[model samples]
Target: MTDTTEPTALLTAIDLTARDARVRKRHRAELRFRGYGIFSIGVAVAALLWLFTSLAVGGAGAVYTTYIKIDVHLDQTVIDPDATGDAAVFAKASYQSLIRSGLRNHFPGVTGRRDQRALNGLVTLAAPYLLRDIVLDDPALIGTKTGIWILASDEADLIARGKGTKRSTKSRNDGQAAWIAELRSQDRVERRFNWQFFTGGDSREPELAGILVAMIGSVLSLLVCFAVAFPVGVLAAVYLQEFARRTWITTLFEVNINNLAAVPSIIFGLLGLYIFLNVLHLPRSAPLVGGLVLALMTLPTIIIASRAALQSVPESIRDGALAVGASRVQAIFHHVVPIALPGMMTGTILGMARALGETAPLLMIGMVAFIVDVPKSILDPATALPVQIFLWADSPERAFVDKTSAAILVLLGFMVLMNAGAVLIRNRFEVRL
Candidate 1:
């Protein structure tokens, strides 16, 4: 038509081989895509490192407490008041005076009620509780001079933890400040592992607070959630995927399950509030109620995951079992379900992990209450770890800041353990068929 020979020559001049312009352009584009993927991975790793570093830096020091060893001279007149070891008399004694006397002996130059009060501020109020325990354990100690390790108050402990010098103003006045400085200079203060943080329950005093109760509550709630959700969810999934017919009702149910899975978690909380608390009249702040609420939230996840796993199993496996004269239920239970078991279990644990981290649903059922006593039963009033973290984070105390960070680290560690368990199950037991 128009210069066909010349046009063909021009087209041939541009080679379509690996060295062609189009091929080189595509190679460059592929390199850019690979670079983007590597960069994304690096960013994710950096973010995780940043998060863990921040938490560790903030909470590591809080795992231990600073103490001052004071020689307390227990006076029989002040403690026993008589030659009798009556329990009531021992309880009524002023251990605070004994501790104050110890502090006074440590620094005799400080006098007057104001200076004494300032000096007394250096030790926590819980120090008296320690002394009381010692005296009650052995009544003979009431009249002896003993060197007891007493927990320093939060301010002094902060200073001992190398938070600052006397100029940091953690003290009430220059006298107490100078006294604390003198103690630090003389190495009277020491830091030790805070076992109380694990053994004690929640307290208004941050130094006396612990997450034991909350940890127990979380365990109890998750136990109930697992007991109720696992069997029901798997059975429901099996019926829907393997046994149920493709009817309008089944389709509606499937659609509703999907919709429920997408619903906001707070809606489930409200549902729990109304159905469990209002209608059934279950005890408020009980782990049982929290677990039931979490069961509802976890159901759709387990069911969906189980169904997907079941669907992944080849139809030939069921057909082969049927050919061997086995019933449909037998084939499913013996052959198919076992293959899908690991996946279903992983899904269940993941769902439980999600439940463990949830606070809003627990809050709706009154699990956000400030409980100091450890719950002895599922029906007892309690708070979960997330709720405890929330409460601590809301407190204005500087000590709670580190405690909150420590709690968050604990929660993260638990979540990682759960996910690792899921991975282990998947890797060890997952059936290829």
Candidate 2:
């Protein structure tokens, strides 16, 4: 008691301002945390840059393919002898001989079966199909000399694209190398935009492959997915938020929804196979089945998002509507739902974007089929872009590597567009609350 004044005076001498030890320690901690956050972001961005650069570099040559402009002698003996419009007649003809004759006409110096075969190596196996289709479209070309730009084989295309040539002298069998050298000297080889890569379907020959069919299938599958998932997900969320009481059953249901969101995508595929394909007897590879599977996967996300948006709506707004003689249903449907729509849409788009990139689920349900024809209906057998990418990535042909990269670029573009759309919707409609 006698020394109280002196102790108080000593305590007062200690600084409690911005320069205090505790304050400096807190500032240092904040700086360290900020540095860590920046470092993490930088790492992520660097990884993305590396991936994009590698893909762009590897795939740049793929956008264009090499072709040889050969004057093919469409001999009647080789193509159509009877001069009939029968497709079967065209199908049975030995178009390979006609192609060989065309090559011989171009380079008279090439002789012997080995040299001839090497010369023929300049074009893809699909080259015959191209010739057949051209002849079928205009039957008049059957007996005439025609100039057509035929696609080169994978090896030749690779050489033209400066990747590698099977004809390199380093190979034990370098006969084709000499033939390719002679053709290059003659300027028969040329590079052009690969329109067939966009207009055609999957092919064993990478030069003949395209992404159109997969695109169509993805669109169809997403359409069905949205149609089923959106309304049902929103309805379920609203029912849980507004009508359901705080019961053990409802609590368990909430927990299950949360857990479902974390479940492996392949599990959903198995569920789809069991319920839709096995039990409901839906078409196996059709977009309808794929869409249903996606819907199940997407439902939990949408419901969670929708409920969160619903809860975010001010309780006072509901009270005001109810106080003004509006029913609870009217309050929620008219006022609350509209405010929550933007959030719901944002969530739905995010979920759809996730679905758009999934391959395993699609694979498990048979969307891995090599569908050449563009799908005309939901029931048609189809493959999505992700599945197509997986298929191409697995292909041994070097050209498929480029195709995979280009497809990835396209997929990234699509995903970016979708995310931007989500942002736009959210910004346009999100309430301040």
Candidate 3:
């Protein structure tokens, strides 16, 4: 009996050792998996940091603009040849000649027509229009010589900012480098915060270009998109989750909605082109059409997210409300819906943010037109921020590189703001069960 008992104890000890070994193996595997997860997260964070840093560095130059201070004799002969004293006369005047004359007077050594042409290239082509507007606003400045700061041409701007390596040689040969240096010595060349970058509209001249028009267009489109998508998406979600009976028809709709959420955004653009543009004859390149296209693209996302949010509410909440004498509709809308509204709004904001950054859909609907005037309404022909960024990125002008990067930063800023709003909404109003 003693020998049998000892053999049994030894077998038990061996089994215990085997079980401990297995447990240790599992712990090792878990540690490895945790390490892998941490590594992946670190990689993702680092990549995002790199991307932001690069964009900020590249776009830094666009925040400031170079200006050349010059004393221009607002020659009445050139500005008001008819002496009609009408603003129309000021508008039609060749202020370019005045600018050229001022430059020639400032540098007496630049005599030849070829050299004079090169000298004129130092200032922005919009300088004449700027002077014309100034005179029209203040007619008193028509005959006086005043010191004015005018936007330097893109090339001169780059050189002043120490970013003109590619054009440095050409500028030196054309005597433009010498003139810039002279202006710098006389305190006539300065770099200042570019208010025009925020206030003006698109321009062939980079210094005169701004994002205001595009920003307005984006806001108008988003307004239209939200107006159309939010109600439709929420109502559809409510009907599907609360009122619709469980059947093959409902199942088919669920499947189709899930599938639509995954469809390419450009397909929706094409659909908008066919239905809104060709069939309905809506204005081309209008923010109204762009918004409608974006609404179609964003609807599926909003519906899917809203449905998920609704499903997250516990069934007990609905049953309790109904047991207390509340009707089915009241139980769902009053208690269940309020609890889910935060999630629904969060989803809608995220969807709108995604739509804001979409260029392809807007492009398909002809929002890619070069719209110079700021739109006053959704029906006006306009270009969105993303579309503007795409257009700038494709430009061949060297200065546009900085403008493109700056525009991207603005786009990213809006996206971040939208996402932050979503997070704040969720945290502030989220219902805990």
Candidate 4:
């Protein structure tokens, strides 16, 4: 057999040792670099996850609130039962006065003017509505001992929910203990869901801020966005990818679309504010205007994604369809569009999600704040989730911090749902190997 040892393997023992040391030194440096790279990546991912967790926790608290139950004894002796026949008389302040007087029934033993004011703090601004409903449900309720839920004010709610702590008048430990003992013994407090948040209007008081109007506004705006952005974006993409001849016009269009995508969203909002609200004279804060603004912003994303989807459809399939006596339009509509739709939908949803989180443009258009009874049409002034969050964050009251977080959580949840839906659509449409 030929000698198997290579020339490199013929070194003396001392030379081999030096060469081995060099190899070890080189490998050690390489391993340290790789380890450091992995460590940095891990740290970044961990920090991002922690931030998301903190935001969700704080924001969730804003969505729910607490209140207490109180029964008002409404008897004919307190109201003139004869006036119930007339709607005008029944709707008079005298009816609400009966409610204010009912507060005395809750704390029968409490005395002093300040004590009376503190007792009134338990009534919610929505109390008038509750009182009205009871009276309308049955005129007989005016004269009967009716135990109804009267919502508490925001401050009272905060104290009950542990968001607001009571201050002790005395610095002494015993003094603070005595004060706490007195408040707890009073026991005129209870906790119930803060339903008013979803149904009431914006007010200086947090208890009165309701999300219903904003929700309606958002729904209307999204409808407008889908109506305008979807067809336009999809059609432009189809033409560009399927039938457009190679020319300067198409090239120019592509360049513009790319440029538009990078423009600041706020700049688009300002443009919408000027073009739609001021120039067109569309109703300010109306869903129609806000939707159009968002449509412009969403269009570029949809067009780019749709073109990619169309291009992804194989030319071989198109050729086969054509050979089978299919018209170009028929081949595209039947074979291409079906395959591309899933991608198109995902792109559409992503664009919509982006629109949903926008606040600046909505604000510019007057969606900053409005308390409509209920949105009857697109022209109704409204607020959206992001705008509401911004407003709540600026509130001086300490409790609004929780509300700000809650709004953020809801916004984030909606965004997550839309993205998840996109993924599901993508999976359904994607061809498996």
Candidate 5:
């Protein structure tokens, strides 16, 4: 063997040099990882921005429509003399036939059945109903003419409202410009504001379809969701975090809540259908039933989030309340809950946003397929906005494509407003401690 001192010195120097090299390598690697992380975040932000811009550009044209003022003349020639003896004389075929003939007179330049129907399609369904009412109410106007500028279809409204060919540009992506040109030749396609989107029902015609029914459905269902989910989820979370004793029993439930949060929403929907519709026999396809299903799916989310919020409250605050002679319940209710509310609201709002966009479970609950008048109550058959969009998106009609995007825009607006309100409430009421 070599001299002991020489071997020891050589080994020690080599070990020191190798250790220094490893330390330097690790430091360089850490910097590279950090740089890559920042770069990935930046790319993700840019991609999201691009996506939002595209959707906004495509969706903004869905809310307004075009219109033309026509001076419609009413006279004895249009209203039958003998029909006046009937209580529902206004519903006579003579009056309808004459009025149809007169409208045909106005667009004399159009002759083909397709062309005339296309122009007539520009006229909204509500327009003729409103006109009929006006004539029936004022019998004195029977010999006179009145001016009317009724709202038109969304495509025509865009043009009449000066939205200028957004669909025309969009169609360029699919080589549909030729068909759009044919529609233009037939005088059926134009950029127009879609007022009906806010006032109409789930029409087979996109121009007649609106968000009103879906809005009502969303409002009623969300009411049900909040009424049922908020109290239950909060209480469950409070019990888990504050009052439950340490045991395998409590631990099992704690794990179960987390697992529930990850379960698929549609599965909850099926459970709701079986329990609420099949067994309980609640009203089928009602907003109440849909809300109940959504509530079940959302409960785990709200409970998990609320529990995190409660955990975030400092232990010192709880101790202080107890030291001041407050009971456990009082301390938790007055101090801990108040402090945790902002975070709780934030979490609950996010979960609600998720719930609002859900359509599958709603589909199972009968919100998937419908084309009826708005319901008078929660028990009425109704469709939520996402489900409405889903139905239209599946339609073969070309116009339904834009209508789907428009409904999505409205749904998106509601979600943004809800989240914004949560932010405002947090800023206004949340305590720093």
Candidate 6:
């Protein structure tokens, strides 16, 4: 009896020791997992901070524009050679000659055609159009001399902005650097808030370029996308979740929607190209077509989100509504849908935000066109903000680097606003019941 009791006690002790070892192993694994999660979060936060800092620093210079105060003589003979006294005539006149004369007078001893041409190169090509607009607006300034702030060339603007390293050799060698320095010393060169950057449209000159057109295009496209996608997606989700029978057809649709959510965005672009552009003969580069393509891409996301939200409502809510003498459609729409609307709106906004930043689809549909005029309607040829950023980033001009960064910041700001709206909507109207 004593021997048997001793062996049993020894076995029980061994079993207890093994159990303790297994428990310690699990605890160590849990600690490792927690550490990995914290490390991953830290890395993600650090990357985000770095990206925002870089964009802010790179784009800071684009908010202000460099200008050279040239005493421009609005010579009637040069600007209105025939003295027609017509604004159209003045608009067509040789304002470039007047600008050249002003530059020559501002800095004497700039003789010879080559040297004169180099001096003229200090101002933007758009400066003449600016002068023409001024003259056309008043026509009284035709023969008077006034100190006008003319836009400097992109290279001169860069140097004035303390980006002298980016100055081209041609701009530097022709005494352009010395001229700019002289202008700065005399306070003729200055930096001011660039209102034109917000108010104008695309230009060959970076100083003259603006995002207004792209902004309008984005707004128009989003409006069209929301108008089409929201109603269709919500209704489809309702039918599928609240009314549709449990059948192979519904199952196939669910699978397709899930698959579409994972499809490459560029595929939507190609599909848009083939259907909207080739078959339907829709206008290329129009916001209407852009919105259509974006709607198609966003539809699946909204449907899935709406269906999930509908599913989340308690079954009791539907039963209570029906017991109160409500029809099937009335119960779902009045009780179930109201409870789910916030989630649907949140999902729709998020999907729209993603659509706003899409470039490949817009590009495939011809939104990459270098559009200088702002679209007055959705049907007009236009470019979206992301497409504009892509075009500017690909440009070889040094000044375009700043423009590209600035545009990217604008795009990011819009995306942030949209996402914030989603969060606000979800929190404000979410039904706890």
Candidate 2: worst 10 consecutive residues by lDDT?
Answer: 165-174
**What tens digits encode model 6's per-residue C-alpha lDDT throughout 184-221?**
88889988888888887888888888988999999999
Look at candidate 4 and tell me the lDDT of residue 127.
Answer: 77
Q: Write the per-residue lDDT of candidate 4 for residues 1-433, one digit (tens) a residue.
A: 2365554456566688898999999999999999999999999999978977888776555565654555666656445556546655655535466666776665576567765555665566667766776676777666567666566666555655554433311222232233223444665454556676677656676766766776677778888998999999999999988899989998999999989988888888999999997799999878899899999999999999999888888888898889999999999998888888898999999999999999888887888865646677888877788888888888887667777776677678788988998999899877642
- 1-433: candidate 3 lDDT, tens digit per residue: 9999999999999999998999999999999999999999999999999998888986877888899998899988888877889988789988898888888888989887777877898899999988788788889998899887888988888878766545335745348878888889999999999898888789887888898888889989999999999999999999999999999999999999999988899999999999999999999999899999999989989999999999999999999999999998999999999999999999999999999999999999999988888898999999999999999988877888888888899889989999999999999999888
Give the TM-score of each candidate.
0.91, 0.88, 0.90, 0.82, 0.78, 0.89
Model 6, residue 258: distance off in Å is: 0.3
- Candidate 1 — number of clashing residue pairs? 0
Candidate 6 or 2, higher lDDT? 6
Per-model tally of clashing residue pairs: 0, 0, 0, 9, 18, 0
Give the per-residue lDDT digits (tens) of candidate 1, residues 249-332.
Answer: 999999999999888888999999999999999999999999999999999999999999898889999999999999999999
In terms of TM-score, the best-performing candidate is 1
- Residue 156 alpha-carbon offset, candidate 5, angstroms: 6.0
lDDT of all predictions: 0.87, 0.85, 0.89, 0.75, 0.75, 0.89
- In candidate 6, position 283 carries an lDDT of 97
Q: What ranking emerges by TM-score with the best candidate at the front?
A: 1, 3, 6, 2, 4, 5
Residues 343-388, candidate 2: write the lDDT tens digits: 9999999999999998878888999999898889999999999999
Candidate 2 stretches with Cα past 4 Å from truth are 1-34, 76-94, 107-115, 135-146, 165-174
What's the residue-level lDDT of 273 in candidate 5?
A: 91
Error of 5 at 403 (Å): 1.8
At residue 117, give the lDDT of candidate 1. 78
